[model samples]
Target: MLTLPNILTLSRIVTVPLLAALLWWPGWATGYLLGFVVYSLMGVTDYFDGYLARAQGAVSRLGIFLDPIADKIMVAAVILILCAAGNDRFPPLIAEVHVIAAMIILLREITVSGLREFLAGLQVSMPVSQLAKWKTTLQIVALGTLILAGGFREQVWMHDLGLATLWASAILTLVTGWDYLRVGLKHMD
Candidate 1:
């Protein structure tokens, strides 16, 4: 269970607190910069953990279990931090929109996770759809762009682009979440 791939996955879950601490101070350009770096590193580990697991035939039950949890934790931490910082720095219109977008994505994540857990207990595994993977990719890009925008708030366009990407990602999230629920619901009966 303590394979290299699993270790990488575990590292991401462990580093979330430090990431959160770095983003705690709103409008601190340096903190946002550090947060971006930490966030990028977490993203890298997320990719490599799965690749290494497949390549090395180290796909253990623990690794499979912890991988998604690590991802959700990291994503949740980043969204919360960005929302807090954005609200404190920007005016209500932009801040509130971004906060709502973040909340939508976060809510979908939690709902899907719960559905997956419930289905797992019933020996039903709902395979990930292509749209869900695209949604995840967009979500990560949107969050990364938003975090980078926090440090570069002087450029109004950066925040605009981030917010645009955020909304796109949220739309995809809702669609994919519905797809997953549709599949899981059939298993209930």
Candidate 2:
């Protein structure tokens, strides 16, 4: 439907490769800064696309389908890139105590996605809950902070704060994920 909201969503999907490329070189601090800027812009567009779609009554099947896919792709790419970078202090974002949290978040995404697909096939909609919104917020903050930490490696606090947020995000992920799974199970045979 080439609507403005749809256009915004597609733009996010299109530019993710550029984001990935920017994060590919671990030593490129300036590149991580640029990547952070790009990632923040993507997050902004994500908010507006959904808002405009709702406000203008322009919601479409295409937008609905692409929105979560774009989000998952963005989140997955950032996580993988950050985890692989392995700085002097953190080594990997998923190292030590952060590993379980990261794994939980990643696994929940996969589980919820599959659950959504299964429910969709049954004509059952799994609406986003308020807690799920918090989960998304925590994820954005966690990843964005981690990216900024990459840009400013000397700031141990930045990475620490990012790790804190990552754990919080993981906690919320478990809660919201179980909620979704519970709803999904009810729709199953």
Best model per TM-score: 2
> Tens digit of lDDT per residue, candidate 1, span 61-102?
999899989989998988877766544345422366567788
Task: Please write out the lDDT profile of model 2 over residues 7-92, one tens digit for every residue.
Answer: 99999999899998988776678988999999999999999999999999999999999999999899888888887866554465
Native-to-model Cα distance after best TM-score fit, residue 104 in candidate 2, in Å? 1.1
Question: Clash pairs of candidate 2?
Answer: 86-91
- What is the clash count for each candidate, in the order shown? 0, 1
Which parts of model 1 have CA positions greater than 4 angstroms off? 86-94
Which portions of model 2 show Cα errors greater than 4 Å? 87-90
Tell me model 2's lDDT, rounded to 2 decimals: 0.89
Give TM-scores for every candidate, taking all chains together and pairing residue i with residue i: 0.93, 0.95
The TM-score of candidate 1 is 0.93
